[model samples]
Target chain A: MKVNEVPQDGNNFKGSDKVKKLVYAVDKDGKYTGVNTKGWEAESFATQQAWAAVEEDLKETEQQVKEGVLSPIAYFMQKCLMDLPLLAKHVGKWQWQVKRHMKPLVFNGLPAKTLQKYADAFEVSVEELKSFGK
Target chain B: MNSTNYQHCQHAHCESGVTSNLLKYAGMDISEPLAFGIGAGIFFGHLPFVKVSGTPGTTFRTWPGTIFKQVTKTLGVKVHTQSFKSVDKAMQALDDVLATGKPVGMLSSVYYLPYLPDAFRFHFNSHNLIAYGKQNGEYLISDPVMEEVSTIKPEDLIKARFAKGFPEPKGFMYYVNEVPPTVDFEYAIKKGIKKTCFMILSPPIPWFGNNAIFLLAKKVKDYPKKLTPRKAALYLGNIIRMQEEIGTGGAGFRFLYAAFLQEAADILQKQELREFAEELTQIGDNWRNFAYSAARLMKDRKSDLVSFDELSDMLYNIGTEEKQFFERLKQVKW
Candidate 1:
């Protein structure tokens, strides 16, 4: 999702159900509380909008990063994590999550620990990963 | 036109109907030399004929006569020129004439430094705008160096140029049957063509974007007969060499230099001269980097497809903006 459109608070899910999928958290009102795209479908209204917004942001961010507005590592971090609010819960666990989850997505045919190691780069915890589904 | 004679003579503005906006903001180091060359090129290349009429001290009508002469010769059209004894008279005279749909062209010596009133320097630049024809009774002129083709009241044109410095016009103009083509420079650069020749040759001379286009169009006169990488490399190399002789700088120089090297590198890359291409690539990258930085400062990056809002922000953060245009397109890491 676009950085501006993203919810600043941890919970405020006023967006549609499609948006709800992109958000792992929600208030009692069914608004998009936060970004946590654990199961974002391309076809859903919220997911489509979120994807569109994210794509646009990514394009801009990529240009900014390419021009050195952000460092390479920071760009990669924001690219992989910022849109997924679920990743924010793991804050300190970022390295751990990168070791466990992102490595597999980034590299092909890697060993099991590679994912864990990538997660370890961000220090993400297994509990945070489990919470992503909730 | 001897370089030294024309160089010292303040006739740089006199020679070319078009002035290099690039000259006014040139920096200390290389920009000065480049500006001189560009000025030389603009003046000598554009203005070829000068006529000091009305018996020198009596009612001298010193204007860019050949520009009109050539137009009239080619198209058989007449242009208007008026000389006023005073700034007010000049302004009134131009206003009355343009009120009938004729805009006046001015020479820097007569209208600006010698005659124009102190309160009217701004209007001097407006008078420099080459008069095209009238649209809806408003005098139309092609102001390629600043604003594109626009129609302004004769009074406003006189007022702006006069405010800028010159109050009276040095040249006379009338409606020519043929309107000059708005030449495209970017397309020529993209297609790997030498542009300086076209700038020197084209009538009323192409300025900036339009000048750039005509040069390219002339280069590729035969459609579907594309400039091959090898040929383009040679052509570009020649351009850089000419630019060196002309003392051109800024985006114009850097772009030519970068394009030359890039074309050479592409040729080598195609020919499996990887190491050579890599070296050329380094040279090209440096030139491109510097050109882009200079262009950003000049607010001349419209060719990069960047939006105005982006340009404003980019101008604020120039260093950061440089890479945004040149960043290697990364493979979409899905």
Candidate 2:
């Protein structure tokens, strides 16, 4: 793309206005040169779509928790942008064990030690983990 | 940490920019394109089995940390690299390195980097940044993607460095200790091009290299038939995000490599490389076009939006063009 043709169709970029990408565009002399771009509409839409999917997933999980079909651990895990396997790795628990913890009966009956580990992995305090959805 | 003694260079990609700026700090004048090309940074892979951020993984460059290692080695620059199991020790090591007036390059997760705009922060763990000094308890950062130097808190730095995910950063850090006075541009550039060709052309699996592009094209063509529109759009969006978002120097590092070729042509006086540069730039433009259409298709669900087959055909063409492009690039005479 030419320097003059570089895409400046800025989107709703959060940090993009302050820091633009140094894109390589052909200069007026038909030579490659670095040109900063605030944002590109195509890329920005792609990003928004990804985040929207995440939020939608989180909302579904939030509903499941409210319905008492799932535990707070399940909600918190998605909230942290983690699935069972990733959260399992962080808390040093087996995949099956983490899956088991997604049950309200299992999660609520857990000891302080296990809850602490889950809280630590989620970057939240034990009290916060306990009081989730309250 | 002496921030004044160092000059940070802004570039199209993060790792190459960091590599060039770090080399510059060591008194070795290297442009971002030169470092990127010499490091053989340009690459393409689409692995549907492998998932990054819950989407099928697609990479436009060599894995993180490879560019720095490859560029430094080709230039015969001595460097020290280390990864830590301890967070405190990692933070201390950074401060100690900065105290010696040397900037430290470390891998960090974008999600924990508060200095970046909210839109850009993700769970990506391979983002590179330089810590030149500490002031008032914040580590001064020279993130290559940023317009200006930024700073980070030690706590946030720890969170970023230790973010749990696939291919964790593990507090990885490296810095240049010495740079050779002279470099053979001919050998380095040829070696880089040869390796790039070999990597893109020689991958045995269908999920990688030129074959992966075809595979991705087939998948794109199938997305609507085999999945819900929402899920299909999500998959397509991930592909676009990989191609355009997070800076592969636009069009999945094609333009960056074209820029490299232009520079290489000037350095080695190879007129053929200039032509190749133009070809690759147009190919890069094609990829951008694919992204543009794909994003629109994703944003709108109507039949009037670009069809899945049209998008697939675009990718298939890109794959064919790149296959031939690299085949000729592989045969470039020194």
Candidate 3:
């Protein structure tokens, strides 16, 4: 496989903040040197596409929360890329309790102590957890 | 104590780059690939049981800190490493080490780091950087993945260090306490090669070694039937991101490993290793092709853009090639 060389023209990178990546470049003597990314077309495009997908997911979750179709806990869990089991482990709560809290009705009825636990797990305040995306 | 003498150079991977940089600062010159290979950094594991961002965990390298630990140990370098439960203690301990004029290596989350582009800032918790000193209220960082040295606010650094998630860093940091006058490169090189070959070829579980490639391929092939279309696309996207985005030096560290083999061949004056290096480079290209096809499938979600079976077949080919490569690598009498 031919090593993809960084393009000579710097315009290949899209973002204003110059993002540099390490690429293996061979010198005239055939010795490999780690060089900074001016830009590689394929890698740059792939990274952009991946982040666009993530942004889309974030927007979709926010829309769901605004419509009250999903609880704030579910929104955050998806946003953080966390599953119930992992979130439960972080908060020291049972998985069943976490599942119950994902219901809007149940989450609204929860007292401050339980809400605070969920908040800590998500690294947000109880107020933020309750009123997320409002 | 200051970081005036600390030199930073870009490298294909972070941990190996940090290891190389740290060793160089301590008056030893070791290339990143040498550090990576001698540290036995190359690996493959596709663990469905382990989850990252709702997708099965796929790691192309060994667990964080393994390379640094292994390289320093093999070279007979004494080091101090610690993980703290409290943020206050972790910061104080880091300061204490820096006051003695030694640079500190730390594990941090990319999400909380301000220097990185927003596109790259996911909730990844195992990113490594060097905290060489404190300037005013900020810590001077030598993040190998970045082109230039950067700084981090004290509070943000703390948050990144104590990030909440699986593989939590917990303010983990390390520094060299002592170094020998010279290291036996030949011995370390042979040992590194042997260990890497064993790791790639010997895992018993289907989720590890060369088996992992096939395992992931099968999982990817079934994504369309097992998951909703949106979910399947997201799953496929994350795999591509892991492979291409998070600084595996392109082709999931295969290119970096090939570079290391070339260096090793020259250092050991072994003609056979040079030939093996070329073979691995070809394998790295195959992995690149796999990433390209996978990325195309992800970018265009239309059903006919690229079939899952075609992508899976590409991965299967990579697996077959790598299995044979490692088998031959294991038999080399260095």
| Index of the highest-DockQ prediction | 2
**lDDT per residue, candidate 3, A11-62, as tens digits?**
4333414566776644555555666665544455555665566668778978
B1-334, model 3: which lDDT tens digit per residue?
5677888777767899899988889888998989999999888899887767666788889888889998998889999899999899999999988888889999999878888876677778899899998888789999998888999999899989998776899999998878898789999899888989888898898988889999988998998789887677667666666665678776678777877888998889998887887787778777767776776776677757678999898888888999999998999886
Better of 1 and 3 by lDDT: 3
Which candidate would rank higher by DockQ, 1 or 2? 2
Model 2 CA deviation exceeding 4 Å by range: none
Candidate 2 vs candidate 3, lDDT winner: 2
For B1-334, candidate 1 gives per-residue lDDT tens digits of 0111111111112222232221111111112112222222221111112111100010001133443343223322234445444566665554555454433454332122222222112112223444434556555544422213445665554433433112233233233223323322223222222222233333354323223323332342321245443333233222222222111221223222322323333433332222322332343334333323322322332334533333233323322222222222111111
Give lDDT tens digits, candidate 1, residues A1-134.
Answer: 22232232222222322111221122343221223221211112222233334456667766654554432323344444332232323233454444443332333344446435435434454344222222
- Candidate 2 per-residue C-alpha lDDT over B1-334 given as tens digits, one digit per residue, 9 for 90 to 100: 4657888778888899999999999988889998899999988888887777677888889888889988888878999999999998998898898998899999988889998888777778899999998989898999998889998889999999988887799999999999888877778888888888988899998977788899899999999899899988888888788877777778888999999999999999999999999999999999999999998898788767689999999999999999999999998878
Runs with alpha carbons beyond 4 Å of true place in candidate 1: A1-134, B1-83, B88-127, B130-142, B145-156, B163-250, B253-290, B293-334
Candidates sorted on TM-score, descending: 2, 3, 1
lDDT of 1: 0.30
**Ten contiguous residues minimizing lDDT sum, candidate 2 chain B:** B1-10
After TM-score superposition, the amount by which residue B247's alpha carbon in candidate 3 deviates from its true location, in angstroms, is: 1.0
For model 1, what TM-score does chain A reach?
Answer: 0.32
Candidate 2 achieves a global lDDT of 0.88
The superposed Cα distance between candidate 3 and the true structure at residue A13, in angstroms, equals 8.8
Relative to the true structure, candidate 2 has a C-alpha RMSD (angstroms) of 1.3
